[model samples]
Target: MTVALSLGATANLGHAQNTLNVATWGGAYGQSQEAAIFEPFAKETGVSIDTVTYDGRLAKLKTMLNDDGTVVDVIDVSADALNTLCKQGLLETIDASALGAGPDGSAAKEDFLPGALSPCGVASVAWSTAIAFDRKAFPKGAPTAISALLDTAGFPGIRALPNNARYSLELALLADGVPPENVYRELATPEGADRAFAALDKITGAVRLWNKAQQAITWLVEDDVVMAASYSGRLFRAAAGDRNIDILWDGQIYDFDAWAIPKSSDNKKDALRFIRFATVPARLADQAELTAYGPMRKSAFPLVGKHPVINVEMLEFLSTAPQNFQKALKFDAAWWRGNGAALQKRFAAWRARVNAARTDREAARKAKEAAEKEADKAAP
Candidate 1:
């Protein structure tokens, strides 16, 4: 059961209101949060919590921060966004002293993963963009490496890739034989950008772009595409029900999702309370059991044992698992913050050209078939 709060009641309400409004990426992720974090905090403190979804757009967040009567109290954002927002002074700097210690009484700062805690944000989960493919689609052989995704001749079928340049560029560079450690360095240069785009050109004919994470898994299950780049957690949930779907941990791009509060939020006290309660080692472990995302707290690992619903061990499926994590790349938040806009413009232009070419080809194919039918009629 998903915990869904009515947006109508939360909107147009000022900080003077009693409820705490949280922005999250809704769907299974939101559901896990509702079960493991929000619901428990609300029950314990009697604080009314309202949840809303966003596309992780910075403009929407900036608008909310600029408004004195904004309803948003806390938001879940990416590390790159958190860094950028913190630097811009749009987010409230969290008081480390107020966060307290972990369940084991260890220092909070020491318990979290390295670089997990920022001036204005704290990480909730470590997630990744991984390759997921349908087992049945590749009967003779399956794609086991990142390069297979770009090798259309070897594995022919529709490929679903994210519309964004962040992960797409990294994967393209990696497929083009760029070393994991050097990916961001290469992406930072004009020549590297050209190389990444050139690599993408090879598979443009077979690629289908998806704007949302869930759509990647849906496209695979529906057979709309044979292979898809998806969030590891989303693919895990879908794979739990459909045995044929499996994730390739190789070359996965790992990153964290952080919780941040707008500087102008009226409910900072309650928001802090919720964040503290939710980040407790036990609570973080509970969330991991509900979803495949790895907890940011190192103490949460020992507590994360099994899937709350499926009874399967959750560690093996996590992106941070020892065996699975070996071949993955850490997403460079600073690099993206510096180069995102320029690369995004390039990516948009390339996608538009590819889409237009595909449209022309489809139109020409239809026109030729019609002309052939008319010729057949005349011959008869």
Candidate 2:
């Protein structure tokens, strides 16, 4: 039921608006980007930057392109989404040679990290999905390892997990003792996936599902859930503020977020100019000053200093930092994109089965209690 998109096709950018509509993430991430990238680009270029918030859903982008083809001028898409969009020809090609040179006068290509450059877009930042747990939940001890995620007895508490299978399956495998680097390779096989599901089965009744990134952190703070899988930046924001939570970087899944021009943009020229300006070493490092995401440019690494508000070192929290990258898993977007449809069907069926079983158990328990009550009445 999956179709491959035509890679070489192009879309038209309709009539121009006075301002460029740039679609991006919201929350602390958005605020950081506004300070580091958007505001600066707008101030210097004299072109108004009109922001549009989105959940990074491709279907929505597809619909916008199909409807008018000029609603959103630019976008901030993840590596996986960018790959699909590039194939669909929904994005304008970015000329790497035209990008601004690094502060050291190095060419953009040489300065960017490996896999950071693509025809789809220029990667802006590297972020991670790390486990953030409530500090007070574990009275016995803290869970410093990935294996503790599924060890319900060792770390007994309700959990919050994303409803999607991508991270869930991978984390389950890691908890089941799969070697860090071999996780994707192992997941590529039938037995590996089965092992992952079996691992998930061990903690069935204790999980609360979340559909959005915000839901994970919200549940951790407001609900009875003890721990959650969430974006590291969100966790950092929560921890930096009032949330009694700390990050567990073990088994972190790392990936990139990129700046891309939607082919439907009426202002491709302006979007490109903004992209070039925003990706400069100084601008990228400025983002790191505010959030936990690591700038995509290698030169930006050293320029990252302390968080201006908190006055703490920012490098340690970055997904690229040596200490954090040791056991980190690079998210295999290609694998997920390829197998997504089939696995989504399988995941839906599995969820149905799990729910049905839980419902049946509840019914049986209630029936047994009713019979015991009648027996006590008859005996009296």
| Clashes per candidate, residues 3 or more apart or on different chains | 0, 0
Q: What is the TM-score of each predicted model, taking all chains together?
A: 0.75, 0.74
| Per-residue alpha-carbon lDDT of candidate 1 for residues 1-380, written as tens digits (9 for 90 to 100) | 32343444334454334478888888888889988888777666656678878788878777767863567889999888898889998899997666759767889899887777888999988899889898898888988888988998888888899998989999999888888889998899999999999999998878888998898888899998989998887888877778898888889999999888888777888888878888888888888898889888878878888887789788767887666776778898787777899999999988997687668768998999999999999994
Clashing pairs in 1: none
Task: Give the Å shift of residue 118 in candidate 2.
Answer: 0.7
- Stretches of candidate 1 off by over 4 Å are 1-27, 45-56, 71-73, 95-106, 139-141, 152-156, 211-215, 222-224, 265-270, 305-313, 330-380
Where is model 2 poorest over a 10-residue stretch in terms of lDDT?
1-10
Residue pairs whose backbone atoms clash in candidate 2: none
* Residue 328 error, candidate 1, Å: 3.8
lDDT of 2 by residue, 1-380 (tens): 11111122232233352357888888888889878877676556545577777888988767766684447888998898899899999899998998988877899999987788999799988998888888788878989898888989999877777787888888888878887789888887888878878888887766766789888888888756788998888878776665468788888888998989987787888788888988998898899889879888878888889899998778877876666767878798788877767666766766666566667767998999999999999994
lDDT for each of the candidates?
Answer: 0.84, 0.80
Q: Which predicted model would earn the best lDDT?
A: 1
